[model samples]
Target chain A: MNTFMGYERPNGDIGIRNHLLIIPTVICSNQVCSRIMQLVPGTVAIPHQHGCSQIGADKERTFEVLAGTGKNPNVGGVIVISLGCEVVDPYALADDIRKTGKPVEVFDIQSVGGSVKAIKHGTELARRMLEELERQPKVPIPLSRLKVAVKCGGSDATSGLASNPALGAAADALIAAGGTVVIGETTEIIGAEHVLAQRCATPDTAERLYHIVGRFEREVERMGADMRGGNPSPGNIEGGLSTIEEKSLGCISKCGKAPIKGVIEYAERLPEGGLYFMDSPGNDIECVSGMAAGGVHIVCFTTGRGTPTGAAVVPVIKITGNKRMYDRMEDNMDVDVSAMLEGAMSLESAGERIWQEILEIADGKWTKSETLGHQEFSINRIGPSL
Target chain B: MKQQIADGVDALIMDNRDHVATVLREIMSGDTVRYRDDHGIREITAIDLIPFGHKIAIEVLDTGDDVCKYGEIIGRACFAILVGQHVHVHNIEGIRGRGDRAGKAGT
Candidate 1:
């Protein structure tokens, strides 16, 4: 129980998966990268629509997410494909990932002649990488090396009453074993930020938590709009969540009662143990993407209405507390704790169900989203694209 | 305690101080449901039709009073809430992050 199986990288990082990742440096090269992935069986490709006409932190984010994805321990090697005329430099991207000591190959469409030629060239490189990746062995890794991200979406009344608290218990269990846990969704924590601030491990950490919440609020106020309808989304109200405060009180319980060790910016790497809060949005795909880019190995997402999102790199384990949604969307759900509502299960046992599933996934169990090929990826944009 | 309900309890009063109990099943107006709080097992009558996962006021709440759940203030009552009345957005108004109430004190 103290160790889970993973592939150890040269940089001293452990990888639960050994994948050959194809990264497109710009939207123009996405097609070539997709073609390469189609031609190579065991490779994964991320075809995002950014990387051109970006400036400032906006441009930096795209590059950082790509580099971080490449550097991710889950990826054994990377093939950086560019259009040769984009703002992001393909060589620089490769160099950033090289710091992780993983094998990386870079090329641009202009230098390779065209999309057709680029796809052909990338396929050749990917085939070799896939062969090398297939040979990697998964060894037992200590639990202290594991980092998990706790997230929730499509929330309803049951989310607060059951799933979030259950996930919180499971998160506490992992932290007790010396693993790290991160909770995100800054927008969702609006009405309950003070409650979280009080649980921060230090005054500095508490200030950072308030600073992020205050900064986000100021931006909204400056725009002359309220976060009401958007945050409690129509779905949230229909599911019986009455107000932002009520929804938030329920939302904060998913991270358990662990003291907040630190507060990190969106896509910022997490520190070693306890619960760290990430200042990320409530959007499911964007939140999961930031956590993966921040180097989390897995995500435990709790929902009442059900969502079928999986990360391009890490496995997403979906948990639900609504019996109706679980039965209706059984294909998308990985764990169910609805028995709590029916008075058939205890809270500790509900959390234990999710805890056991996490250990199983760390040892290479494919989540429902992964089995369905739901490798959803997205990067949250902070500023307008130039 | 996450409010450990002994087996067979039909509803939950999450905290001893909460004025509302979330119904676990649909109940018609005037139906009685059993719930447990730190006060021990008790029964409350529904003054309005309540759906599963929706809260029922177990204590009378006057307008502008802080509505509590999980032992914390979730919002303020916008109207008088009678015991057993279904509590929801129609009755409670959140006091935080309101752009519409900007610059107003004690709204």
Candidate 2:
């Protein structure tokens, strides 16, 4: 059996990484949380501008992403810090993460006194968690247990021509090996949704796919704005993507040819062992963050124009079909498949190269994004904060 | 067997059903570019100075015809286009995400 060394969590999930995550329950707690992460080595922090003034589904989304990040199999333990008066229930969030059978602790900055005192308290707690996390043993786990997310950003024509399709081939290989793959960026799938809808495992799945796309379109319509104004962004247009449809056609190719098992909401816990599609925004950091919150162990991000985005908890492997961009942004890119266009490399070979990179990363090799300290995290918000 | 030309391949046609091909390298006007697809190697003369990664019409298209690439309709030709002409925002209009252009044939 093909296997990679991973941290086997008590919940029976295999984690390619063992991280001590520091989470801020509200925007007010960001400074304290950041201070703790800065004070403690081997700890990661996700500080977002949310958790307060959000109502209904929006509030639930913030809570879900926060709790989900803590519950990710990659996290050995979590320390949630909150402002005592925030709308989000920090204790409830901690309880949710604790259900994963991992150690979870929560504290409030106001309750601990203030910034200075809270920073000290959080740092001590984070240090203890990191020490415990460092003691966790790594065990060999079947590669079939891994869940990977596929995404593309800063895309150009070469993304469609080479990298995305090569990534697709790799995605297919992982699925065939019994792993799970999730693809997102609903807006990016606008033109090519019909193609994806056809790949749904069931008629209901197909209908849900169309429904989410339609809902996103109607939401954009409600704002009396054109999605084209934001999508096929200026950089995308300069990179030779003429329309949203052209961009979508290329974007959808990264998930490979597997039948989409299901369509899921953003930050929703993914089902096991197949290809799934998550409805998400096309923004680079936000999309990757959602996948991280959805419990993906790694993200394969294809870029043509180049971007340096990574997730707070997930390792991002940046692949680019633009050799020029890769050369220019070598510090940010992980794999360069541009040779496929030159005929020096074949698509299948490129896919194999990426698959090997995935296995190596899963086995504890650091990616460019991870080494560069690009732990970017953001939540997609649906409504304005009060 | 057909001879496989290794050099001077400046563009790629992803599918036989595609109406457009993407230029892999910059091509000056009047330059002959060779592209390969499943059908085999074919050549077209560039009518415009096509930049790298941009599309060139592989088939002539009338106004309002769907422009296909990757064997899928990507957009609609906004005006008459001849083979080898650059196909982009100037001649091809996106059929999706444009609130004003909704309900088009491809949408």
Candidate 3:
């Protein structure tokens, strides 16, 4: 079938999961939000460390990510909680989300008297929002409205050889079906960006692609450190990735052979269908979080060393190429393409298997990460605290 | 197709022009490591112990030469590397995105 079950949003976007997301606008509101989530059923809360004492780009990122997560079509309603005196404006955040035409309610901890009172007030708000969301009927969403992010973490050599190529094939299939595909982790694009540049659909995209890469490299250089200090991270080196280029070459394969239509900044909303690249950190949680905030409905993650990471607002499907790691971390992994390395399975067959899994997930099948409750969230911050 | 394990094509050369092959299994010194690429299945002897998933040099590389994998330059060789030797962080250095070595290795 070319369509999946989803809820129609008033903003004209289709959401596969009708999540009532509890957003903490600042660190002081996290405990209250968490309490409300526990007190009310069918609620998810995102607890973050920033939103206080942050200045300039750092503070702006926290606001943009929080607001974008609230605007994500996957979320049907939102409850924004604040600490009253943080740098990020809670009411402003609520206003940003309201622009999406979704139901959003905002309140601050200081005005509500304290944590206990705040939790009580937030729980009541959540329960009512969730009830309203439950009344929304599920409708069919075409593949054209679906956007999936391709990410890789804890990569080993086999990632480049097996699972990534398999995922690349699946990515191509998704785009062929009129779906949108996004690939991020600009940190992984260091050496082989030339290959991506050559595949850009326009000169503008190629320039933007080069601009982001060059900017990241200059920043890393300004810090007086090498990308090697953290990249091809110890786990990656142990798993057989020797250099940034080798790791990046493997990393890029998961996005397939589609021409990049655009290169967007972190947390920026995506354009309509075809392939796009988001300039995001290579850190797993940060990259996935950025993509989720950018309106991706699902994340197709490839790992070689294995990770249990998921996203707070979107479903993350874990695909691996290491047979031993998959067997060891079977509970965390959903698809295993290691047979391609053994020559037991063709690349196309392995890719088809992943493609089928993506379809099933879009139809409401829970991913291993979702089933295991791996809702990991992180925001990429530039600049520093005041 | 099912003869992979028994046939001893235990390693892979992702591209035919790559200078190294990734061993699918641990290889003891002097063991014949078999691999397949565009040229089909080929064999080389490991002169040093290579761990599983690590690289085994398929070509001789001198210091300052590019270490090729996936048919692209992964790093620059800091030390001499012989055919069948282990190629890793100890012998190869990443040449991009560093400020300490700025103005060197452009492109």
What tens digits encode model 1's per-residue C-alpha lDDT throughout A1-386? 88999999999988898989999999998899889888997788998989999999998988888887888788899999988999988999999999999999999899889978888899899998888888887899998888999999989889999999999999999999999999998878887999999999999999998898887776666665556677788788778788878888899999998899899888887777889999998899989988888889999999987888889999999999999999999999999999988877889999999999999999999999999988888888887877
The 0-to-1 C-alpha lDDT of every candidate, in the order given, reads 0.88, 0.89, 0.89
RMSD of each: 1.6, 2.3, 2.1
lDDT of model 1 at position A230 = 76
Model 3 misplaced regions, further than 4 Å: B1-7, B103-107
Mark the 10 consecutive residues where model 3 chain B has the least summed lDDT: B1-10
Kindly give the stretch of ten consecutive residues in candidate 1 chain A with the minimal lDDT sum.
A219-228
> Candidate order by DockQ, highest to lowest?
1, 3, 2
TM-score of chain B of each: 0.92, 0.85, 0.85
Per-residue lDDT tens digits for candidate 3, residues A327-363, read 9999999999987777788878988999999989988
Give candidate 1 misplaced runs (Cα > 4 Å). Answer: B104-107
Superposed model 2: Cα runs more than 4 Å off: B1-7, B101-107
Q: Ten residues in a row with the worst lDDT in model 3 chain A?
A: A220-229
Top of the candidates by TM-score: 3
| Cα DockQ of the candidate 2 complex | 0.47
Q: Candidate 3 deviates by what RMSD?
A: 2.1
Return the TM-score for each candidate structure.
0.96, 0.96, 0.97
